[model samples]
Target: MSFNEIKQHSKARFKCESNELASIREYVRLKGLSLGLSEEEAFKVSLAVDEACSNLVKHAKKRSLSENGFYICLKIYSDQNQFIVEILDKSQPFNPNSVPSPDMQEYFKQFKRGGLGIHIMRSLIDDIAYFPAKIDKDYNVLQLKKLIA
Candidate 1:
């Protein structure tokens, strides 16, 4: 089916494990393409989504997540002119923004081991917003938005 024939909203549930990363990226890429994103755009969004999910899975391995499901919800808001990808889990109260971006020159010079997830996500996604679980809601959300090109 072509992009114009696709629906505006969809979702998928993934386990909070590194094993699910490839599937997550594939889903995002396919859905992004069907939602009017170019192959390159879809890949970028997929990469960003992978980074986001990877960070969550890594952190989830460290702490206890009360929620069993990690969800990826996709929405195309034509009026708003955006493609939104939301990663929801009952994550602990931690802000992704707190991770400072590494200085590239220094990072390459010293050969940094790891710490580029947030940087990668931010670079590919137009906006990243974190919404903590509220009184009514039961899960923390990492919302990633990309302009519909």
Candidate 2:
């Protein structure tokens, strides 16, 4: 089902920070459990969501106290026995697929420190897509999903 189908179940606009990571992780875990996911599946989804949020914090702009910190929006829905999580971040526009595969041999190369985020994100989720926000002020959207079974 689309996000609108369960929009009411979604929680939007969470603070983004190294310290706030745990809360986001727990949030994902709790949401997954509500969808009938086992502990293991929920933990996996939590870790994946954490990794995605970490990437946003590391690469996105830092917010002052006067401004809202990075935004982490989550939507929960089940596809048959599988659970899907959508995370939207107010960071720079990034397309995970657009990044090239990392080269192990060149990993130590200081200038080649790219694509690792995309790689980790890709490994954790079953499906991912990037969509530009229409508001022209919101961050690029990154959608992630996983199967519970």
Best by TM-score: 1
All models, RMSD in angstroms:
4.8, 3.5
lDDT tens digits, residue span 9-120, model 1: 7777888878989998898888788777889988999999888878777776555456554443434432235677878777664667778888989999998888888899
Q: Provide the global lDDT of candidate 2 against the true structure.
A: 0.71
Q: TM-scores, in order shown?
A: 0.84, 0.76
For 22-132, candidate 2 gives per-residue lDDT tens digits of: 898898899888877889878878887887788877766643222453667776667554677777765556666687767767787656655576777677778887785
lDDT of each: 0.75, 0.71
Total residue pair clashes for candidate 2: 0
